[model samples]
Target chain A: MLSIVAALCGLMLVATKAFTAEQIASNHHSYALKTIEHLLQQEVPATFSLTDLPYGECDNYIVNQISAAGYVGEIQYLTVWRAQQDTLSMRVVRHSETPGIGDFIDHQRSPWITQFDFESAQAFTTLDGVSGATVTSNSVRRAAIGALKTKDIYCG
Target chain B: MGEPKTKQTRTFSDGVLKRNPAWIQLLGLCPLLAVSTTVVNALGLALASTFVVVGSNVCISLLRKFILQNARLAVFVLVIASFTTIATLLLEAYAFALYMKIALFVQIIVTNCMILGRAESFASRQSVGKTFLDALGTAVGFSIALIGLGGIREILSQGTLLAGAELLFGSAAKGWTITLTDGGLWPLAGFAPGAFIVAGLLFALVKSLGRASTEQPPMQLKGES
Candidate 1:
């Protein structure tokens, strides 16, 4: 009985996955384009591929994935670069930092992540991290630096 | 022994009010308290949850007779997980922003006590129609608790209602934000701690309201809490 049910459930999952994969991928593509547009502060690019980065022709706008040595674990983020190679924005897209404190790196939870926006790479150096969440802030800072310096970027 | 049939309305209201899983039974409070800080997030999670509950209940009811007793829980988990995956994929395809905000929390619905409890306690034995109504009732009850909490928190913390109305209602609703106050918002209410504070206040409010006709007055509630 368990095996039968498991087989049926697995079939249902496979069907659903096939049905939605394309639409979900397209949705993600549009979102990445929107983020790239925001960083460039210009008309949405004619085309951009996340796999092939330094996306915009101007190269002023880039979104790169970077993982820095965070306090609890490596912090993974997408750093949006713009304007004379400054960080237009930094979002902690994924992280395993402590909740209630370190997880504040997520903009949905706290605007502390906004502090990195619009800061040039050189300017980012002198910035103070979030008081209580120093490790997370520093981790995000390191991630952003790496993202900005990397030639390969992850727009997503 | 086979239990006597329950009245349809009574069964429905039991899930909605008298035995509300969130307000009274207090099951599935984590998502109720966590993802409900904003109206759109609350609505997104609630809809996804309702989808899973209704779908799993249907599947569980249909398959109840053939289940091996010992493996019943495993079957239930598989059915629930399948529906949850479907819901998550749909949300990703249609409402990407809202999905991202809630992707982690929504996946946890597979483990939500309210949905699983319904599957184990009722859907496993009940007829299809009754289970369907119960699932809807349960979803409605959960939605009420979540939206109520979300409304209060968003209003106090953001100084605006439906602040990011587009996420759920689409581009047409992007202009739907209604600024309630020029007074500054208390940012704390927008975070985790504020959910606890607001949920506590809501619990007290609901309890006090329940007491009004039987044992109390409105003025007393104001002073008591």
Candidate 2:
């Protein structure tokens, strides 16, 4: 009986996934585009026109999605690396941090997220984190550092 | 408990009014307080939770006979968890923006004592038909509590109704926000403590109403029997 119930559940889950996968993907794509548009401060073209920079090649600007462990769950973000200046900027793409407090990482809520704008990744160690959201701040910092390290390893 | 011989008749009001899980029993306060900051968020969670509770109830009722008594709790939880996952996927697909706002609450519905409590106390013993009605009534009760708290919080915090209605209702709801005040009357209302204050007042109101209804007028000033 347990096996039967489990099997039924599995079947239902598979069916629901199959039905919603396309719409979910489309929604994610639109959301990503909107985020990129806001972060880049420009209208994205019909297709994503930003050149995808291959790793190991230092370029003026490059974008990479990185994930790091946050206070509540994984924090995924898009980081822009400007290797020539050793500066990085990031925007959170997805996270499960507590609302109101940790959510200050959002640029709309507070200017704290702008602290990452065009700053050396090492600056995170000296910067005072958001008063009540240290873990969330650290998560974004970790993601930024990871993105920088990736550039360092491949570009050099 | 022994299996009952017949299905028991119950009324919707019994769940919504007389024994509201949120107002009276206080079954699921975690998500209740966490996600009641806005009407859209509250309603989104309510919709997802309703689906989960109703689906789990129906499944559990159908499987009650086959479920071993010793393993029934595990089985019930498995069913509830499955429904929650499906609800999460559906929300991500249909209401992506709203889903992101209340994703944590929606994902944690599997642990909501309200859903699990109903399964253990009611669905495990009732027929599928009866269980469905019970689930609906409970869901309605929960929805009322959530939306009421959400409305009050949104009014106090944002000074608007349906401030982000578009997230749930699409572009048509873009203009649905009805500004109630020039600015927030109480910005704290947008936070967790605000949820507690409003919920406390709601609990007090319900208690007072229940007390007033149950209180009997003093017997005519007659000698004590």
Candidate 3:
């Protein structure tokens, strides 16, 4: 009797898990997209794509073309905002970091992120440091500089 | 032999105080250590564990007689795994955001020693009523320990109680987040070391209290010569 009851309950639970798998995947995808959109406001073209390039090889034309320099590091750069476009907005999306402390750079509380708003691509190398989150801050700066350099290459 | 009512009461009390799965027995340390990072996380884990424990106890007790003696362990695992899967699904459907945050830990509950421990030690041999009471007592004790650990971590680390209140208590409690830290200080409570230290302190405190209660001499019965 007990085995029968247990089996029945077990079957019910499995059925529920099967039913919700799709919903979980959908929610995960939507959440990821929203996070990306929030960080890189719509001023840049919405048709942008993400590509993984080697640390030293990322083509940051904005920094290289405008300032004659590039960054060194394995980074992801958001190539948005053509030079012809009056308004330019771009950013590096994510990085590996310890939670809570280093992760603050990803959130709005960190001044480091907003510094990218109006600064020239050359300013990426000289942005003020985020006191405790220096490593994460540097990573973001490198990625941003590389991205801007890449943008200048393709769009300039 | 049928156990006396007083013996059953004693067993139930033991589940709550003397042999609590979290504080005293020290079972299910995985979820206890992982999810206790925040009050809401701990609360959600506690509720889910309680449901599985109690539900399994009841179901197992009902099936005790007919279960093959050799296959009882297999039976228990299946029953527990089933409940855990159901819990994961329910969280996904309704509490989608929280479900994502606690995804890995929820599945890990399948291996929590406390649930399997109860099945082998108590549920397989006890009456349904006694098993129910025992499971309830054990679950409540575990919940208390989890919430206590979670509350301490949440307050000290984030400098607030219920920093993300809406996740557990709904939007009405959205503005209830208290700022304990001005984003200053290395937030120790949010990390793994913080969890180990807090759990260690709580364990020591409970152990000392248990010693004190046991040291007290029993009162002499009025009719005893």
Candidate 4:
């Protein structure tokens, strides 16, 4: 009887673990996509594809279909840009941040995040800081600037 | 030794005032430190822990007859672990956000010596009613300590009574947070070091009072020697 009870409990634990893991992963993915869409807005192509770069590699490229945004003049603000006929804006994705304090940068609560939209490459090179999360805000800014600098070499 | 009623009441009072787990015994320091950062977090954690401890004690008492003398420790652990798992699942299903915030601290409740200590020391040899009262008293004592610690930390660290109200009561409390714009240096309250200092001070205060009461002379009875 004890063995049977133990087995049932073990099975229940495993089932719950699997269910929660899947739910957490799905929630994280949808949240990441929402952040991406908020940043790119209408400039993003409807059928753009996502690619995972090699681990620890600096440069990554995303192919976007641009319709409204123009090329050359608009290319500098391209945190992530593709060079096929029309220019498409691309941005590097970030994962994980301290809750409440550092995580607000991912949301529009801080207008500084919106500065990436329709920016010149020069302007994009220097993102401003969020009032509270200095370290996280600076890190995001530095990554955005690096992506803009390497856009031509990777996307062009 | 006398009527079970009198003995049970004594056990209950012992847990609440004399042998209080948090103030006197100082058991379960991990969750006490980690979740006491906010009033709501502390309250939620305290309630969850109380449920587990009480449930485990009752179950252990019921099974005391069947448990082998040498395997009592094993049985106690199994019972506590089972209750802790149930608590975790309930939290995950209903309070996902708070569950995430509390995280591993919830599981650590299984190892809280207070629960197992009660099981071994009180429940294992007591009647069901007595064990139940003991568990209730201990839980109340633990909850009081948690709430006290959380209140101090919240007021000092965030200058608010309930800083993260939504985490406990849900979206209805979205605007319920009290903001203290001028809240000063709460470096001790927000960090781990602050938790230790506060817990130590509270423990010391309780211990000193206990010592003082014990040392006081009893008044003479009218007919006594």
Which candidate should be chosen as best, given TM-score against the real structure?
A: 2
Best by lDDT: 2
| Cα error, candidate 2, residue B26 (Å) | 0.7
> Model 2, A1-156: lDDT tens per residue?
788888999899999999999999888777766777676576756856323432223666666777899889898777766667767777776777876679777664567777767778667545567778888878876777788777676667
What tens-digit string does per-residue lDDT give for candidate 3 at A69-132? 1122233333333233322334333333443455454432345455555655456667666677
C-alpha lDDT score of every prediction, in listed order: 0.77, 0.81, 0.67, 0.65
Docking class of 3: acceptable
* Best-matching candidate per DockQ: 2
lDDT of 1 by residue, A36-134 (tens): 565556665465466665455334565565678777767656666665654557766555565566777877667876766766665555557888888
Tens digit per residue, CA lDDT, model 4, A1-156: 345435544675677666666665554344445545554453434443233321111233342211111111121122344233222233323323444455444332234445545555445345566676666655655555455445444444
Q: For model 2, report DockQ.
A: 0.58
Interface RMSD of each: 2.4, 1.8, 5.4, 5.7
Task: Give each model a TM-score.
Answer: 0.79, 0.87, 0.65, 0.63
Q: After superposition, how far is residue A53 of candidate 2 from its true place, in Å?
A: 5.7
Comparing 2 and 3 by TM-score, which wins? 2
Candidate structures ordered by TM-score, highest first: 2, 1, 3, 4
For all candidates, the clash counts are 0, 1, 10, 2
| Of 1 and 4, the candidate ranking higher by lDDT | 1
Rank by DockQ, descending? 2, 1, 3, 4
With candidate 1 superimposed using the best TM-score fit, by how many Å does residue B223's alpha carbon deviate from the native?
A: 30
